[model samples]
Target: MDTEAHVTERDRSSDPDTREGEGSRSARFLDAPWRRPALLGTACAAFLLLFSTFVMQPFLIPSGSMEPTLRVGDRVLVNKLAYRFDSVPQRGDVVVFDGTGSFVREEPAGNPVTGLVRWAAAAVGLAEPAETDYIKRVVGVGGDRVVCCDKRGRVEVNGRAVDETYLYPGDVPSRVPFDIVVPQGTLWVMGDHRSHSRDSRDHLGEPGGGMVPVGKVVGRADWIGWPVGRWSSLERPDAFGRVTAPGPVGSHG
Candidate 1:
């Protein structure tokens, strides 16, 4: 009788339903209220990271290079898809590009943690731009003759004057004299604050002659997204009005 009683107890404990009930209770504990929010927060963070890295990213103004148009500390939205569909950047468009082999001294560096934080900040439109990133106006597109001080000290593109009224007050179109015809699939960019900026003109003696390859261009700056009082849509300057469309590679004034 004792043996039979012991066996009956053991069988009851070994039942599949009994085991399943304990598993269900364990699962409920593991999925407590806090777990949901934690998981959700993680998912949200990952989505934002992906979006900022691969899609549109917000960049903050860190220097006076693009001043008057983009002030220090102002945030701007960089449209990554703008160039993905289109093959070239247009005149008067503000562009951001990787300065790896083109302009900046060196490629930017960041560890995993720092990168994550920066990405989060940029996603929220608060972080400053990366060190190796550059923002400038496209003065000459592929196959355009961009010469400085065209008799009246104005930059000329395809034999037409570019009215740079948006340039910083007291800033000339270019203080450094340069005369170069942009090659096909390349761009010549300059800053509005010509005196304060180190643009393509700065690297005229360097490799590639300060010209940014079309492949390196990131996107156009379409709007200023932060600092509500300074918010405004970026308009294409009407300065290129009389400029002719790009013709043969070497044909220009």
Candidate 2:
């Protein structure tokens, strides 16, 4: 009698209705209107965070420094893999870079946790760009001589004058004159609006000679991703075609 009683209790506990009832209750709990949507939203955010971190990043233009090339409120899509494989930054290519030692003295101190969140937010174009981030056109590359204002008041690279039609209207190539050779593995960058930009020319007196190390480059600005009216690619200027590579033969090799 005792054995029969125990078996009857065990069978009741293992009933399909009992197990299914527990599972259904759990499912209902998870299916709360807010909870399901919240879960999906979190999954989407995580995907964007990863994609923006390693693939491409949307950088917001904070000011008019880039002017005609990149206007205020423009979200430039930085191609992170542009130079990741075997390529290097070339003259006339607009690039986004971290200017820690080149532009800013040092990185700002911040809590690591907060900083990570802020950086992730900026990566996906959800927040403002970091203060140390900068975007500019490559005027001179490694081993090239960069000079401001030739006889025609145009910037010169490798002894050839560059016709900058992209310059902000009425804005000169550079208001402050400078002449320097770009260091190997570094880049001399400038903004389209030379008058208002504080670019490599502005940092000529400081260390690195206003040159941004190629290693600091985040990526080339491939396209304008935001503002439906301003959707277009940032093409490399043909003016650089005339300028030869630093070495002999006047070739791109």
Candidate 3:
């Protein structure tokens, strides 16, 4: 029996031309000019949308209402999960919330296309938020006596005077004096720039008693995220530390 020559021909795949052709095909497939950039952009957009909806949201200060602490052009990062747990907003924490029925008697329905555009712009802090949204600092929460213009010209919560170091220069604690107890599950909020803000105080006579329901709060303004020079973390001041909890109803501290 003659043994057959067992030499196997060289593999075609090992040929230099075949290898070059394969490489060229791969290069052509990967070199689609727009694919990588488009994918990256889509991923980035999805991440931003998720972050803005459930993690942190970017909010553009639309007016001087928050003033010294949050300038009109300042962009703040709101912690949407701040109060999602058992905890609630505490005194001195700046918050953003819906103003419907409290600050806004009604929200007019707008064109869906326009609404979507507005939402996109607001999401990136490029435009002012909807008219039904407002921002202010929590002065009292859930059954705290919030009094304006104490004997020392300062606001008081639960009978303790607040040292408003964040108040706008030359701005009093409140020019429109009033006294009220923050109802249960609600917040008594005010703008640092008392004179320029139309906050809960402005709607005292309205249906909601100028109180924002805790349920309506969108998030806590935690930091100034834009205008590199203005970047800063927002901290809850010690002013509220001295404030006690709710006392007897209709009692003044």
Quick one: best TM-score, which candidate?
A: 2
Tens digits of lDDT, candidate 1, 1-253: 4656444346656889998999899899888989889989999978877776777777888889888999998888788788776556889899999787889666767698998677577666777666777899999987788888788899988778788998999999988888888888888999889999999999999998899988887778888988889788888888887898766765652
Residue pairs clashing in model 2 are none
Looking at model 1, residue 162 earns an lDDT score of: 80
lDDT by residue for model 2 over 1-253, one digit each (tens)? 4656444346654889988998898899898789989999999998988888788899989989999888998998999999987899999999999999999999999899999888888988878889899999999988898787788898888788999999999999988888788888999999999889999988888988899999999999999989989999999989889998776533422
Q: CA lDDT of each candidate?
A: 0.83, 0.89, 0.89
List TM-scores for all candidates, in order: 0.85, 0.88, 0.86
Cα RMSDs of all predictions? 3.8, 3.9, 6.7
Candidate ranking under lDDT, highest first, comes to 3, 2, 1
Q: Ten-residue segment with the worst summed lDDT in candidate 2?
A: 1-10
Candidate 1 TM-score to native: 0.85
Candidate 1 residue runs with Cα over 4 Å from true position: 1-31, 108-116, 246-253
Model 2 stretches astray by more than 4 angstroms: 1-21, 248-253
What TM-score does candidate 3 reach?
0.86
